[model samples]
Target chain A: MQFLSIFHEINGDLKVVEKELEKYVLTQEPELTLAAGHLLKAGGKRIRPAFALLAGKFYRYDFEKILPLAVALEIIHMASLVHDDVVDASMTRRGHPTVKAKWGNRVSLHAGDYLSAVALKLISQYQDKRVLKVLSRVTVEMCRGEIQQISASFDAEQNLRDYLYRIKRKTALLISASCELGAVVTEAPEKIVRALTRYGYHVGMAFQITDDILDMISDEKVLGKPIGGDLRQGIITLPVIYALKHSQEKEHLRELVTKQVKSEEEVQEIIRLIKDSGAIKYSFDMANIYLNKAKKELNRLPDVKTKKTFKKLTSFIGERSF
Target chain B: MQFLSIFHEINGDLKVVEKELEKYVLTQEPELTLAAGHLLKAGGKRIRPAFALLAGKFYRYDFEKILPLAVALEIIHMASLVHDDVVDASMTRRGHPTVKAKWGNRVSLHAGDYLSAVALKLISQYQDKRVLKVLSRVTVEMCRGEIQQISASFDAEQNLRDYLYRIKRKTALLISASCELGAVVTEAPEKIVRALTRYGYHVGMAFQITDDILDMISDEKVLGKPIGGDLRQGIITLPVIYALKHSQEKEHLRELVTKQVKSEEEVQEIIRLIKDSGAIKYSFDMANIYLNKAKKELNRLPDVKTKKTFKKLTSFIGERSF
Candidate 1:
């Protein structure tokens, strides 16, 4: 809700994006339309699109020009979530049943593929080769990050470097591109584009770190899923990697995690151990580090209302609770 | 082996595409590299890239300009096959274990996704907006076709119209785009682009119909897959659709097919019934109809060596045994 206030000036543009997104999700087939519409209906913060809009605001803003890029970015994010649910075997996302949960993995796979292709189709209208190239590169990196995450699942030996690199590709690059593409499409100066891209990269890192922290400490009621959901799926996030390196109960935690956590009781016990291990504070501290770096990048841009809003967004990411 | 002779003139360009494809499949992660490499090394006919090359040859051929598009087309085709195996629960392709069979479905899904992204990234190097637009549209249609195929699977009520529509999206569109993109990249005359696209479309339809016939009739060793594979997987193709419409044993065949074919004997019995119903000949006749249409399109182009090669390729599709 706080993120909504950041969009007060651009609320009209956001509405147009929402309408365009709804229109894009409508497919000829009833089942596909339903599957794609499911996620579009279960909304999020629309952070990526908002970021794209804000970046455009730094220049002469035109909603029509920015609309397609913003919609495409959000669709790409949504497609990744669909596929992520399949890969994670997640039953729920954002307090709602995932595509995989309602229609089996096969349908989910094709749905995800469809959404991704739709994103490309929408952006193709822009005719900016740079935007297409950046988007294509980001897509490849995001998939590589996912593939790496899967291969590294439950490996307690993974270091901070690996964790940082994974999150950078999985979460940061797309967000970075969102900012860069917005500025590039709006014909902003190269320096401004670079600054905005750096800001997005840092903010994205903090955002994902907070998400990882929430998976460990947030309640099922608040988070829409069980705590340690990632652990149950064998996904070792930043906190878990930190806990593995520094926890006093490293041996017991390793034993519980190296093997699958089958029981709910076992999952809760592991959650408790991770919380007691000081990993949460370490993750928050790490997130703040990135947030501060994001603010520094924002300072490089000229003083404007949009600049303040961008700074507010970084802080918002740092403090977001579910 | 017969297809190799068809590539005799463009052999050097095809080699470049092969190398480009190999380069694109290489990744930093050992497991991903291996999974993707496995499929790339398994070897396809490279028919999509060959089509692109031959189309370009009709105009002023520039191997450099055509190489990226050709490689991208083949990668797209390869990506679909990887995902298709997972969707079909197939164990082998061309007598080689599939990515899903070698690695689990999760890994195969990511690998397929990665390859698709790579294809997009490869084409991004070419600064042609039309190329990007056409490729994106084709990718969306291809995914839609796959989704429709899944939803229609095991449904006995689907008609020939549905079957033709699905294959046009699944097989024909990308192949059609390959030809169109080839001509477009070369800045060929608009009339030539239209002719090549028509030729590709007709050729693609015939190619898939031939594939369907092979699934029902070819030897496992020769086809590199079990006979009646489409039926076993509950995929009703043109031949099956024809038999369902006209066979004297329609009632019994419908009963056996509507239920799962749980036994090898049942599969064999259904195969025999469909064969005796003359569906194979009807399917071949249908394929020839499209083949003739394709040759008609080629005739619109000027008399050139490449035009003759294109005609020969269509004939090869009509007569290819494996």
Candidate 2:
């Protein structure tokens, strides 16, 4: 096998899996087909499915077994995005108009349901009962996360522990399940499956922490949406929470939250305060901590090029726009 | 062995199932828990799940095997109700405030997601692959039916064939699957499974037809809601369709629909016209047809007391006023 570097050749298995996703997402609704198409075309990184395929390589990688899990995970992710658009009242996703903006909330909601139903249907193809149980539990956890987030909006004192738990349920659990179930479906060793699950949990925590930080600092052009949209909506994310704790301007920040800020200028001003208060850097440090932990989990795996690539991914997450 | 009069004996089993339902409807959020509880406490007849358990007894009465499927079907039914309240923008369900009205549309949507997730999770417990496949497909069809109904709303010329298909997806498919899968989980023979499936389909169709007829003639005091709610929302049910086909005052009815009548007086007038035009009787006749069909399917079942109660249920559907 080639060494894990940018110089290494990409696996043909991933290419086939990607091709299957493109085909699968195409065959959804006909009336809302275009809206479902819009969601698929919105350009997710497909990171979860990638983790699934990589984990699959450790086992007897049967395309039939691995592909359904990958597709199901991706579809679950897509459904969440559709509902996220509704929750955020977001007009665009990944630089394109969202289903809600294009077709209205009703259509978007139904499209999301259709996507979820399709995922559940696809997962039934697997004979492994444990895999189905994992998927079912993940879906429940994800919904509970969404519910928690909805109810917790604007609660400045919600604490880091609750925030972490929410994100773990919302983002990390599904991603962790992605890796673990990928191994289980492919019949990987129990040790490797457990290790990959740990890796996924930490990596996903890092990924979300980075995303939260990026929301406060990234360029709008690169982010494909306005920066600090989360803060504007009174979502007290990690960076905001950190800033609130340490800043001299805590009263002013709370005041701004109570009285909704309307303009992009005000939003940017808040973002500046958050960044200047060292909240973004603090968040970055926390993300790196998780990345380091994720890297350590891979030590349980054998000395292989794929393991190295997994390490590279951890590093990439840590260094991403630091 | 008791002959076919065993439907009422299911009350104890239903009470046991309802207690479990209360346990499952619990939530971390008090407001949502209470709102969902309102629907749960509205005291529905629990016909779908009861049918599943009763059918299960025909082979081997293992409530343990049947309980999950029964609860799952009811949860799915409740999820549909939550979403339907949002789509209809209604404020009440079964004489209590709906989740949408109490918690707003966002929470209502998420709560529906939570309910559906619970249903799917319970379903995943069964080791039988066939059961999983049937339940998942039924969910997909249910979502599709909702989409079709949303799109077809207020289309006065919408085909009767389309209407029947919509009811099949929205109501009958899950009910039929509950019976069929209940048998499958118990390892019941193919012929009994087929017969139970048919029984569920016919009963479900009759149920919807009764709902349509009751919309025209039942009192709000008895029905626990305003009569003509469907017509008020511009849902052209079987009675309305029949009235439009045969009534000389069809143009007047269309004008009333366009007027968007809201007052109880206007609702009563529409109800009177529907009743006077023989549309109510026509709808009742249609319900009787399905009731007879359901009875015919029951004839294939073994001669037992539970089966007799099943027959009584068909007659009950035909004769029940509200």
Candidate 3:
């Protein structure tokens, strides 16, 4: 909510986008409508759509022209989340039952697919080929990253570079594409587009790192999910990677993670090891590095009110606690 | 093999599509390449691409221009199959282990999604918004149909219309889209495009009915899967619907289908009831009606050499023993 406050000036446009998203979610099929509504009702930060709208502000801002693209990006994000929960066998998301949990994996899979197809259909209405190309490429990369993550799971041998590459594709690439697409759809200057894209990349990296930190340290009530959920599922995030590389108890940590931990006590023990290993500080420093790079890229953009909003968004990303 | 040989005149073009499909399947990720390769290697008739190319022949045909569309359609088909197997929990397709069977559901899900994204990216190379629009709409419909099928599984209350609508979206729409896309991409006259699309729709309906019939009666070795596969999975196909409607043992049949049949004998008993119900003849006649309709639509096109080939393809669909 604090992050979304940055869009106070454009609240009406955001409301329109929210309505458009709701409109798109209505399908002829009842089950699909229910599944989509469930996810939409769970609510999100709508960060991708916000980035798209913010990027459009740098150029000529027409809310109607950008509304479809914004809605499409949000749908894509929601679609991915539905499938991600299935892949992770997760029970809850953001304090709510997942689509997979509520409707079952089979329904969740098709629902996710339906939402993605809807996104493509909506985006196809636009004439810009580049926007479609970017979104398509990013979608493919995101899937590739997911496949990589699945294959790499429980493999304690993975290095920092592998982790970074996976996160770049899984998280950063889509956010960057969201920023790039906003500019491309609005036909912003090439320089401004490139700068926003870079800014998005850095911000996304920082954003994911911050998320990893939250997964480690945040309370379940605040985080909206159990802490250390990623580690429990054998998903190695930045803190885990750093702890594995630099901690003296690396072998013990690997042993605990490489095999399934059957008890809650074991999971807590692993979390304690990760925290005491100095990995949290290292991860925060890495996120700060990306945040600085993001701020630098924002300096390249022209002097506009939206530029300040972009910077504020980046800070919000950096300072977000949960 | 006999059906594919009908493409003798366009053999070179078909080969180009095959090679392009192979090229697209190659990926930097080993597991994805392997999973996609497994599905591709366990081949189908390539009927959808053939429909696309045949539709292309009505206009000034360019093999190169039509290849990507053909390949994209095939990839979309393959991707759906990967996901479908997961949904049905099927063990084999075409005498080979399914992606889900070999790689687990998680990998299969992501692999299916990756292939879909690749199809979109490849199609985006063409500037035709109509092609994107058709593909996107068809993909959405296909997902909707799957969700409907799942939600309506073992539904004794489903009518003939419900069955037809499901198959139209699940099987026929893509085939229809293939033919329509081929004509659209080749810049065929609107009259010819509409005719081919109608032809594809009828043929696709017939194809799915034939497939449903085959699922009931075909030999395991010949069909590359166990008979009664769809019934076991509670997928209420045309034959099953017909059987439930006309069989004197309708109550018993419904009882057997609505509950989990735990043994081979129970499945075989249900098959016997369906066969004795004269559902086989009803299904074949229903398929022939569509085949005749498809032939009628083909006659609306110009009497090009490809017209004869299209007629032969329709007969092959109707007459396929396996």
Candidate 4:
């Protein structure tokens, strides 16, 4: 059950999205094409598009109408990753060189802006105001979340609520928007749209928590980057937050986490301590809560097949490694 | 007359836009507020908004309905400047510290992104799809123009077509969109909207040419920046393009222009060579052509007062020193 294969039924629609992305990003500047194309080539799960397609199934499911929105959602996701790499100056993502690593931060910054502009343009073709409103609000919140991440970095007093708001804006809202947008564009009933949106929010939260947990405990090879990458960047995720409050080595962990510099050995030590503090289990428990809530929303939908697929998707998110 | 006072009749409306900017950019992060506020304090002409307001006057003027659009256009302009400052690594603008100077490039980068997202969200409230289409198209062209500028920087082979298209995409299209969006929103006929768009396009071209000219010849205290700023950043502008073609010292100028690094003396010498070549006069001549064309577009409009104001605005664009 690979993530890409999970959307096997909608693979034809996903291919259209892939083609549209290439057509839009292809420009006169060869270097720009290369930089902008780097992330597009590094295939992701297409989770946002998949969610949109699935959510559309409960209603009319006009693939042609949904195509632009699907592509726009994916581009927005890609744009955020490019900007995130610029801020962290991360050279590699998912085992591929980032735009920043290849073309420098200046080009990476503009490429991200270009992709966002392209996404906005694509969405502009839609006749509905709700689609634009949903996407733009999500974009604004994501920016606030990014700024908050920068300011809150290395703050020893970082709390659960701060982390929750940041991750929700950064991840959940966009995912939620994808489902809401797909449903809206297909003329879904209001009740069904709200249910799908709630499903997306809970699933997105569960997905991000799983990602943070894996960053601490997963192998570097499996994670596609270094271990404790978030810790190295002073990103204070859930495990670190929980461990800070309850770990036996709480004082030592804080000292290591708050340090301006960390060697490979220090990162290894920090990861080890976080793993032993029961924070991993605690994070999973919280994720299970979200996953269950996500499935509960699927119960409100009409189609048995789509509902089953969503439940399976929720389970996969709760346990995904990469 | 000062640029601000040029729009004396619209001062109260501009006040609302200024207040709205403060409201939208004021986030939870104090650092973000400061970075986003830096350029607002620097206070360039609200040229784009003025163009929009005047364009709207040709038919029906609904200030309440048009307010969001006016603010969005201004925000788009400001966003581009913040991004431009980041790319140029500029320390000051209009005699005030840039966002990049006060808060690092990372913060400045996100602040630009925040502003763009806010602008897009503001436009989302519009019932008309044409507004989004025009603005988003302008945004994409600007990004392409920026990428082209990067690719063409410091190249000895740069030509007039490259220079014209770059300036048009970077400066003219947004201004054109400002006018077009205003007209479209206010229920203007297509022909009048096209005329206003042409007016904006020509005025914007003249405005950027004059700005480039001022960058070379104006006092640092008045220009609010050092001379040869564009050359130092490898941004080949209109005068440099003109001088590269016809200057007696063409070979020497090309040699200096294409160099990886330049001294202050070299910059001053390059400026002198360009000035001696009459390229400044040549650029102003071209600007005058655009100014005349811009005024011609106004003959199609109805209101005598607004048309006179637009003509006066065109002249101001052609001759402004700062």
Q: State which candidate has the highest DockQ.
A: 3
Error of 2 at A15 (Å): 5.3
lDDT of each candidate versus the true structure? 0.83, 0.76, 0.84, 0.83
| Predicted candidate 1 versus true structure: per-residue lDDT over A164-232, tens digit per residue | 989999999999998998898898898999999998899899999999999988877878767778887
A5 Cα displacement, candidate 2 (Å): 10
Question: Could you give the candidate ranking by lDDT, starting with the highest?
Answer: 3, 4, 1, 2
Model 2 per-residue lDDT tens digits across residues A1-322: 1222321323465566567667756654564565467766666567787888777766676766788888889988988886664532221332333324422566657767878888888899998887888888888888888777766776777889888978898899888998898889988899989998999999999988998888878878877877777876656789888887887788777666444444666677777778788988899999999999998998988676678778878888776652
Write model 3 residue lDDT over B47-141, tens digit each, in one string: 88988998999999977788889999999999988776553222233234443443366777888899999999889988878899999999999
**What is the DockQ of the complex in model 2?**
0.43
Residue B309 lDDT (model 3): 94
Docking class for candidate 2 = acceptable
Task: Please report how far candidate 4 places residue A208 from its true position, in Å.
Answer: 0.3
Q: Write the per-residue lDDT of candidate 3 for residues A163-280, one digit (tens) a residue.
A: 8989899889888988888888888999989998998899888989899899988989988878878876678888888888778888988888886543577778878988999999
In model 3, the clashing pairs are none
Residues B1-322, candidate 4: write the lDDT tens digits: 4777678767788788788877776767786777767788877778788778878888888888788999899898888877765632222332343434322666778888999999999999988889888888888889889878887888879898999999999998998888888898898999999999898999888988898899899999888888888887788999999999999999999999887568889999999999999999999999999899988988887764778778778888887888
For the candidates in turn, chain A alone yields TM-scores of 0.93, 0.89, 0.93, 0.94
Residue-level lDDT for B104 in candidate 2 = 62
lDDT of 4 by residue, A1-322 (tens): 3887777778888988889888877667775676677787777778898899989988888999899999999989988887665632221333344334422556767888888998998899888788998998999899888888877877779899999999999899989988888999999999999999999999999999999999988878877777787876678899999989888998999999997568779888988888889999999999999999998998889974777778888999888888
DockQ comparisons of all candidates to the true complex: 0.52, 0.43, 0.57, 0.54
Q: What is the docking quality class of candidate 4?
A: medium
